[model samples]
Target chain A: MVSDNFFPQPGGVESHMYQLASKLIDRGHKVIIITHAYPGRTGVRYLTNGIKTYHVPFWTIYRETTFPTVFSFFPIFRNIVIRERIEIVHGHASLSNLCHEAILHARTMGMRTVFTDHSLFGFGEAGSILTNKLLKFTLSDVDHCICVSHTCKENCVLRASLDPSMVSVIPNAVVADNFRPLSQNEIDSRRSSAPGPPQPLGPNDTITIVVISRLFYNKGIDLLIAAIPRILASQPNVRFIVAGSGPKAIDFEQMVERNVLQDRVSLLGPVRHDEVRDVMVQGHIYLNPSLMEAFGTVIVEAASCGLYVVCTRVGGVPEVLPSHMTEFAAPEEDDLVAATNRAVAKLRSGKVRTDLFHNQVKQMYSWTDVAQRTERVYDSISTTRSFALIDRLKRYYGCGIWAGKLFCMCAVVDYLLFIFLEIFAPRERIDVCKDWPKKAVPVAKLGEEEDVESLKEGGVPGRKRNSRHRREKRDETDESSAA
Target chain B: MTTLITILTRLASPPPQTLHTHQPTSSTVTYTVTTRPALTGLCAKLGFYVGISARVVLGMVAVLVVCLKWCVSLGIGISVLGAFWGEGGERGMRRIMKLIEITDGTYIIPLAILVLFLACKRNYKEESLTIISGLGLQTSTTSSFYLRSPSTRFISTTAIQDIFIHEAFKGFEVRFYLAVVVEGEREVVVVFPSMLPRRGILEEVWREGRKCLWEMGEKG
Candidate 1:
């Protein structure tokens, strides 16, 4: 996978790539990630799960995305591809210049490429217009496209004008282990074998609505600021635990001060991703007032933590969870306040099965399922015939009136550059690195024969290896399926 | 300098107006000034100042530095060219002098024509809108010493459909007025208030303006 966002920069994309790559490795696939150098994090590094990562040195201009030095990345990229003997190149995030450049180069080198779009962008903005054109250019020759949500798939298809069938809807998954709720045994021990079982809520008990997101304008901080005072005034036993900080945090603090809600509202400035579950479990409802989102992974994490979600119905959020787990609201102050009120009332009435939410969410999404689906995409691409240069050129020719011609010229130039490199640095001269030992999938007959031999003989190391592999696989399945 | 000022004054000489019986409290006026400072503004990194006095002096110094830098760079370029041509020795200097003497007339006509062309062009006019109490609004503009009489267009507060207050970067505030008549005619009004020495004053004006428009609805 090639992306600008990776480890050491904590974000949704970074977490998604890490989780997906690790799960893919577990499923018996050798995965490597290529990214631009981050501060103090340059050179090759091996992450957990033995996933190789190559951090190439490049100049980053904004938001950690390297400046678009298109042709400059080709030499190093070609060397990595040759050395690794990679058959497919998977790129993530639309705004990543490295991903776009790698996709172009990978196609030039006659390899199957897949692009995963993680966010939504409106065509009305000038920046979006330019980015959409670039997306159209890159995705023109790509084998398949993956989107985190169905809405995102629609958005990607529309933006790139790709065939709908080629675009797949693969939602982002949260690791259930990391976001687990309080177990029954723990709850029982804490409450001294707990009175009855556990009530979701009581009338007199304060309902802490948790909000953990960057306090930015598009995150609907304005709507949040407008609704907080009214929500407090209307609901007497409701409090808020706001985590994460941004430019709009001051606005929130000012609103809290103006409404004199310091006692009721606790601001835990910024919390790490791992600490999110700890903060989330402290609340009964997770309030997400974001105006725009592709797939709200935090809400799924919240649900996994057994917190009822209250989020604005915008940009794939509604499709993320079932109605039972979430209360949807329009992107407005009145609607958000009403939604919170509804969630609070439901919590008070003990109607929502929040305790059972963890198990239900675990069944809904898993990294194993995502990796399996991604593998299917890879399998399909290998069987399909590779597109001719003219066919690829034809796809790019339909991007825009002038953009079409410009893109075709770029493609032609890139193809020529690839041919020149092929002649100059003949592929035969490059040395392929030895692959790591593969846990081969043995046939049933061979396994049976081996089992008999192991029983006849004293012991076999292959028997131990087979048993250990099966145990690890069983453990993974058990942990993933466990609530 | 005297001739430049005279030309500036002549250029701003206002056109004759048909006097009306009703005089408005607020009016708009236009005039011209030298375009040299604006060109200097483009050359320098000096931002447009609203009201702070200290910033104006700093801006002037920055523009002056840019002007001096350009002059010094040009002098160095000419000296370097002269040094390269010094292989011809003293004879090269004499030849250049003769060449200049011969080309002086040829350069004068084009320079004169260019100056005349530039003089015909008017300097940019800066527009300001002032909110007058018990009246609609007044607009005015000044260039050099010439102050042209402003013309006002009265608008009833009842006509205002909506008022939008936009706070730009660095405390700059802009107000947009959307007005619609009962007959379905639409009118738009844009206003930019002077940046005060202190913050919050523009926001105060915005609130007051919004209040006035809303109160007009009650009166209507």
Candidate 2:
């Protein structure tokens, strides 16, 4: 996986990469991550489950995104690709400069490339125009593209002008075990225990609505600020627990102070990823008033934590959760207020069966299912013939009048640089690294272990036998020398 | 002299290191020459000097143009020249011309030469790992310039701990290097710090060095 976002930096893409890579490793595929080095985190490090990561040193310009020095990353990237014997270069995130460069260089080196678009872009803004141009350049010749949702796929297809068949919709999944709701036994014990805070809400009890998103303008924080006071005023039994911090947080604070609703509104600034479940279980309703989203993995997580989701109907948010579990609203203050009231009424009336949401969500989305789908993508791309230089240039030339020629020139120059590297730093001289020792799958996961064994049997018989024979011969030599 | 083996390897940079193993008398001397002959031909040196001179001249001309355009008006330019040639005229003009010539030759030319020299210079001319049977290990680095003496350390057979090839992150990528862990030292001494050859070369060195050290240990 190649991306600018990875672990130690928390975001949807980072967790998505981690989960997918680890799950792919579980399916007997050797996975490695290539990302720019974070502060004090340069070098090759091994994450859990033997996923080797090469943190290439890079200059980060803003918000952990590397400066787009197109050709400068080629040498080091080529070295890593050669050393790892990488067959497929999978790039993630449209905003990542490293991902774009890797996709270009991988194509130059005649390797199959896959790109995943995680966010949606509009065709109207200048920033989006530039980003769309870049997306067109990189996705012009990519083997296949993956988007987090159907809406995201359409947006990416429109932005890059890609064939709909070449793009697949693979939703991001939450680790269900991590986002599990409070069990009935735990809830009952909390309620029956002496002198403790109320655990379960009565019919007339104060319903705590949870809002856990970065308070930004695009997140519809202004609508949230407007809706909060009205929701509290109309529904005397409703309160709010807001988490996350951003520029618009001051607006929320001012709104709360202006309304004298300090006792009802509690602000928990910037909760970590692991603590999201604990916060989610405290509320009966989860509110996500974002202006736009690609997948909205957080709502699935909220539903898994047994909270009824009240979200804006924008981008891909409507497609994420089932209608029964979610209350959708337009991106307006009054609509959001109505949605939250509806959710609160449903919760009070005991009409929504939130207690069973965890199991249903687990059945609906899983990393295992995502990994299987991604493997199918990899399998399909592996068989598809890669385009030659001329064909690739032709495709690039169809992007725009001026951009087409510019992209063609860039591809031609990248190909020349590849040829230069191949001649000067010959591939024979670059040493292939030994793979990290694979851990034996625990007996608890016997089904997966058997599946992997079967996959090995069905996949590359000669290479597997050759490596085993080499190991046996080495052992024999060691034994002979000992004797 | 009987040469046992020779290995040639290149680093990320252009210059290649050639490792030579000599089995003379009872000792094994394995040394690598890291310094390639600097700017070999006279034509190359002349070309480099000419290029530097052209760059310096062009830079001076650009600076003069920019100064004339932005820093000084045409009247000031002529007045400055007039001041140089007008008052205390001949002697001052001659002295200023001499100062310019001296500055050109002494300052800029030598600075360029120093840069060329530094670019061509290596910290160590050669590094060697010697194993005399029953006498432990000896590693030395010969200085490229005469300003610093060669650094040599001999680990007695008893003090020698272990020699192995290890992988480390150098700059942007992971690299393989050979290191010697002394008996009591906190840090292991890297064998070749400057020219870190590939893993194949490092593995060969590790195997041969360990065999020489341990085989002799058993014999003695």
Candidate 3:
């Protein structure tokens, strides 16, 4: 699969790409990655699971969308496609110009293409318009599409005018074991013998509500600003612990000053993902008032950390958690305030089993499950590749009157390129790389044991897996998958 | 209010309509004539334009008059006023104002350039809904200026789309602009810069094909 987004960049899309790639490798696909060059990175670097990444040299114009020199990329990309013998060209992220250009060139070079969407975009805004247009141009001829969630699928359909059927709803998953909740013994030892698990807060205990996302407008920092003063005024004992920073940092500071909440609301700035468990364990509630979300990984992380979640019911947030663990509110200032109040009250009353949320959330998501679902998409598309041609034509047909025709022309061009490749430079000319050590069979069995193990783990079990048998089996799986 | 009280009540208080001497409307002619719908189809036209025109027309014109005197009012007009008129809203008012401003800019800018060579010894005489080229005075959505000439009525035809679309070399594009004339019906204004063969020449051909659109309001 070809993508311009990979490791080093720290974002939801970036993480999604890395995890999905590694998992694909585990499943025994001879997965090689292609991305624009990062500052320090160049050439092919094999990541943990022998996943080869090709960092192509390209102009890094505005926020890493490679300078769109359309035909400039075709020569080098064709060389890579010839070298790797990539049958599938899969691109990730909407804003990546490299991804879009790669899709265009890959189509010209004749390869099946898949695009994975990670964020939700509105029909409004110039950025989305530009993206939608570019997306329309790229997706107009691509084979299949995957989105992190149903909302994201709807957004892709409406944005690029793809058929809902052509686009699969494959929600993003966390390595559930990685996000395990802290055990009572671990918490007690870590808290310096904090007197019997800190005793579920008396009516007077300072309820520390935590916020860990970067404080940006879409993260609903504006709502945070407007709601903070009122919340503090009414709920005196309620304190806030805010982590992460962005343009809204100054606004958050000013709010703290204006309301004299200097002592009440603590701003811890940015925290690393690994340190998230430490930050989260300090608060009774995790507040996620994100204005829009494709899949709220942080809320899941927060729930996994044994914190009752108070989040806005926007984008894919409502679908991520069951109602019992989350206090869902409309993306409104008053609604958020009321929801936070309800969460704090629930926490104070000891009616919520936030302690049990970690195990529950772990069962719902995993990188393995995501990889399995993705494998199905690959099979379905590759197996029915012929009839899927008409399905693609119809999808491109719906893009728009002019755009529809333009898209069909692109698809036809791609088909012609496929024919060209078949005649000259041929599949025989391309040399396939040997597979790296794969997930051991014993590890596969252990993964299957997650259903039972997750329950007994009680959230935090520092059980890391390593087995020789699984690695050998993983290699066999890759050989078969490629064949 | 105190000036009115001093003028009318002398020393006693209460600013009232009767006792005041220096009439606020003294210099202004009070035309109480409710403008009858003079043109047959004009009533509907007026109605269509009212939500947009009420600020520059209805409120001042229902008690219609050509004000012999003019003063600049600094306020959020039509939009805020629309709330009082009990019709549409700030949206229609803004649409009307924006249209008027755009038309004035597009035409007047060229006209003003043409006028600079004219030997009129006028103090930058400007007109309402007037078309002129630049050089003597400047105007646009971000700018408003009086010609040394005293023309009150202003119209601007600011084809901003033309300016931006001219530079774009790659990718498919659509440019939309709307024109509302004080004298004519509102219409959309468009300009196609060039044709992209891979993208297509349809929008370009349509652009060159439609000359009547450049002339005046005949909808496509």
Task: State each model's CA lDDT, in order.
Answer: 0.72, 0.79, 0.62
What local lDDT score does residue A444 receive in model 2, on the 0 to 100 scale? 21
Please compute DockQ, using alpha carbons, for every candidate against the native two-chain complex: 0.00, 0.11, 0.00
Total clashes in model 2, counting residue pairs 3 or more apart in sequence or in different chains: 0
Tens-digit per-residue lDDT, A119-156, candidate 1:
99998999999999999999988999999999999999
Best by DockQ: 2
Any runs in candidate 3 off by more than 4 Å, and if so which? A190-199, A387-398, A401-432, A437-483, B1-220
List the candidate 1 regions with Cα displacement exceeding 4 Å: A185-195, A439-483, B1-220
What ranges in model 2 sit over 4 Å off? A193-201, A439-483, B1-125, B128-139, B146-148, B152-174, B178-189, B204-220
TM-score head-to-head 1 vs 2, winner: 2
Interface RMSD of 2: 10.2
Q: CAPRI verdict on model 2?
A: incorrect
Which scores higher on lDDT, 2 or 3?
Answer: 2
Q: How would you encode candidate 3's per-residue C-alpha lDDT over A239-358 as one tens digit per residue?
A: 899999799999889889887888988999987766788888788889888998998888888888888999998888888888899998898899989989988888888889887888
TM-score of chain A of each: 0.89, 0.90, 0.83
- What is the two-chain DockQ of model 1? 0.00
